[model samples]
Target chain A: MSKKELIVREEILGSNKKVAAEIRGKMEAAGVLVVNLLSSPGSGKTTLLERIVETLKPTHPLAVIEGDIETERDADRIRRKGVPAWQITTGGACHLEAKMVGKLLPEIPAETKFLFIENVGNLVCPAGYDLGENLRCVLLSAPEGDDKPKKYPKAFATADCLIITKSDLIPYLPFDLEKAGNEALDLNPRLRIFVTSALKGRGIAELARYFIESRVNMIQHQRHA
Target chain B: MHELSIVASLFEILEAKARENQATKIVRVRLKVGKLAGVVPEFLQTAFDSYKQDTIAAASHLEIEEVPLKVRCRKCTAEIEKEDFVLVCPSCGSTDLEILEGMELLLDKIDLEI
Candidate 1:
């Protein structure tokens, strides 16, 4: 029996990356800032997103694509806040693929300045896929404990920013802010961090401001380059 | 699990490559997966075994090379290898470190018979 060795060096996720780049190109041409939000189930991602939508809708046109294993619940919640929302039911897939997100881009409002793609509530699988977003944010609620950064290092390392949500519950939880923040910093030194609580409206304004400023900065950088 | 999806993607790549080379069957697939890539090798193998049936890779073998996490200390310029996720520099104990290696999931090569 004769065997042949073929040196085929290719990426397993090449198709996904290609689609992600195409999505990024489309978003750039439309002048919309896309942000992919990642977190564990019950990590307050929806609550924080509701706050963001409420605060930014008047000033900036916004849209949302909600990903879930099986539901239109999150999308409906965003729609009630007066923003256009689309739901992608993964049906059993733990994470959203770039191709799936690309298909829904046309449904988004053309004038939308900010488009938030709330990934299925999974830290592990979502971290491996890029959805062609301008920013990637990972949220860890105080109730989830501070060891999440250490346990899910890939999520923290791949994120552009880290959000510590449900900070209002810090007093009742054993979560240490310093430890969590430090662990995330160790994984990614350049990660922008925000401590927020949607219930008290604490740090919501700052978070909203960050999005605005980040969009402006990206536009400026693109212009200069 | 996500491993199943990853295996599906792998099969797609294998099929395309086999078609390009006009190969009748795939013999072995070699992959490089880093420690920080967040994939369990055992799960990936199991997924491959279940999905390879009736495909060109039905009788193929999968070999995964686990790459260790490596980092460079910003302060001392020392390159360190770590088994854990902690990014501290062993020499200086500084948290200022840059990841040089790890976080790679690549399909390196495939052996085939025409």
Candidate 2:
């Protein structure tokens, strides 16, 4: 056997990108605004989604795709809100791949205007995988500390928006609002920041409005294009 | 860990490459993993060692070269290198930045006993 060095240059997640592109094309053709929410465990992704469902359901149709390591609890929570929800149990995987999401693309409600993908509650793994969403928002709850942006820079750096959740707990916690926001902005200067408290209903309306306006703008932009 | 997931895929590419090259066994595998590639190299090496057993790469040694974060300024068109994620261009201080490097997760080459 001859010893030879062979060059085999290949991108690792190139296949995933193709899958993500297909998903994006399908959602775009359907005129659905897909938003992917990512954060650590107990960052209130489900709570925020539930609130968003209540706010948007009366006017526009919405659907959800929940990703978790196990359990359909999140999907169940969204289902209780009367919106269509699909739960993707990753079994033992750390993140939801585009292939996993693509498998459920046909089941998405046809009349859905907005589709929310609540990514697996992991700050590290989920951020690296693209699920073909129009927007990627990362949540950092006040109780999780203000140092997360620097510690887990990829999540904040790649996020189109940063939501500082649990704002109501600021009085009882040592979380510095400006520090967290500043650190996130340092990693992603163009990130749209929002301080929200689901219990207090603060900033929820503005966020919901932003989503509505974004979908409208996207549709209009596509029309012009 | 996700490294296990990545290593599995790596083996797929390795097997295909080895077959295409008509290699009897893989001796050394070379990879270029960027700092921003979102993979822990140690974990990946460990996973590779675990998965290489009984395969064509059973006797192979995994070699990983880490690439650092590098970006280009959209405003001033300057390239900058950093140890970690930096939002703006250091020279122009422009927030309009484009990533030029440091996101690579490439299987560059492999040494095979053909």
Candidate 3:
């Protein structure tokens, strides 16, 4: 009963990472900025996307890939805003995998300038997978309270930007904006934060401006490099 | 919920490694999971148990080693093992710290019978 030991140091998400890189390369080549939005359910991801599409569609050819456990509803909503939208239903998976996103890229409109992939509404599993986005944004609604950063540090830490969504509810809720923003900054010092209320259209313009400027900067940087 | 998918991916890795080594049966699979990796060990174990039935790792023991979150203080250069998701420096009480060890999910090694 002699047993031999094999040292195989490999990442479980290695295949996903490789496919994500390929998708990133494709998006970059096509001059499209991809953003992956992650959050818990009812965090107003679809609402925020609706606002973004309403504002950005006039200037940019926008597309959306909505990921849900089982729904074409989000995709249908985005399509109503006059933008191309696709839905990738995971069936039972908690988060969207890179391969799943990659398979739907060819279906996106050819002239899309901005591509938003609203990841499955999950704060935990979504952090473990990268969908080859130019930016990864995690949204925390004001009603969710300030302790979310402390509770789900991985999601806050991995995010490039943290959006405090539904900020208009602060008058009714006990959400401390400063505390939540500081806590997220502590986890990830480089995170760019925005307090937005999609329903009121507050901070929507600034967020859209940031996205446009960043995408332009990335393209120029890539060209010079 | 995602642990099941993680265990499925782990099984794929284990099968490939076992095939590479010409091992007929896997004895044990060792994984290194950091606290900040967002994986629950018990959930992963349960998922592994349910998913390993018809695979090469059917009789293998799943050994998971938990790694504590470690960070380095930028101000005091203090290395601290943190719990409860606190990101402050222990020595200087500064929030400006770099994470040294955490957020790791690695398939470390496998013990197999050839």
Candidate 4:
């Protein structure tokens, strides 16, 4: 009975990281701006996507990849907007992985400039997985309260953009916008903040403008690189 | 939970490494999980215990080393470390900070019974 120790230092998510990197390369090369959205259940992600499609689809080629535990309902919503949308149901998985997205990459239209991945509704798990997104936007609905950034710091800390959704409910709820925004900004100073009420179209145009500009900048950066 | 997926990935790596090293069974596993790595240690341990039952590492012990979140203030160049994720500089109260480490989710070592 000989006992031996093997010091094998490795990354647990190395395989996923490799696949995500490949997906990023392919999408970037295709001139697509991939956006990964993270939020808790009922955070207005689908509504925001609908608004984004309404705003950007006239000029920009848009598509969606919806990740959920079940159903094609989300994809159907986007399809009703006259855009190509595919659904990846994880069955029981809480997060969407790169391999799942990479396998469906070919389904995206060749002319699409923006590909939005509506990640699984759970905030905690999806924050850990990267789906080869050029931009990661975390949504915090007004009804969800202000302590979300402090409680789930990992989601806000890693996101490139933060969208405060369902602002129409701000008048009814006791949610303090300043507290959440400030805390989120503190966690990630580089975060681009957007306050939006997709139903009322309060900040939808501004968010769409930012996305369009980001896509342009991405293309220019690629050209120069 | 996502911890199950994480543990699955961990076992893949461990099984490959054990096969490479010609180890029949894994005795212990050490993981380095940072404060911001988005992993719950308790859930990870539970998942590890459940997943290792049918594998070669049936009796394996999983050790998790939590790494603190460390950041440097861009305004004052002060280094700070804490388990609580406050990303502001204590001296200057500047939110402009650069992270040094603490985002690690690494499998550091494995002890085997050959």
**Which residue pairs clash within candidate 2?**
none
- Deviating ranges (above 4 Å) for candidate 1: B74-76, B92-97
lDDT of 1 at A153: 91
Clashing pairs in 4: none
> If ranked by DockQ, best first, what sequence of candidates would result?
4, 2, 3, 1
lDDT of each: 0.91, 0.90, 0.91, 0.92
Q: What is the lDDT of candidate 4?
A: 0.92
Worst 10 residues of 1 chain A by lDDT: A1-10
Fnat, model by model in order, equals 0.75, 0.81, 0.78, 0.90
Work out the TM-score per prediction. Answer: 0.96, 0.95, 0.95, 0.96
lDDT of 1 by residue, B68-100 (tens): 999999899999899888777889988788888
Question: How many residue pairs collide in each prediction?
Answer: 0, 0, 0, 0
Better of 2 and 4 by lDDT: 4
Please write out the lDDT profile of model 4 over residues B1-114, one tens digit for every residue: 699999999989988988888888899999999889999999999999999998988989999999989998889999998667778788898988888878889999899877
Please give the DockQ score of every candidate, comma-separated: 0.68, 0.77, 0.69, 0.78
Q: What DockQ was computed for model 3?
A: 0.69
Candidate 3 lDDT over A122-188, as tens digits, reads 8999999989999999999999999899788899998889998999999999889999999998788
- Clash count (model 2, backbone only): 0
How high is the TM-score of chain B in model 3? 0.93
Q: How far out, in Å, is residue B108 in model 1?
A: 0.8
| CA displacement after TM-score superposition, residue A123 of candidate 2 (Å) | 0.5
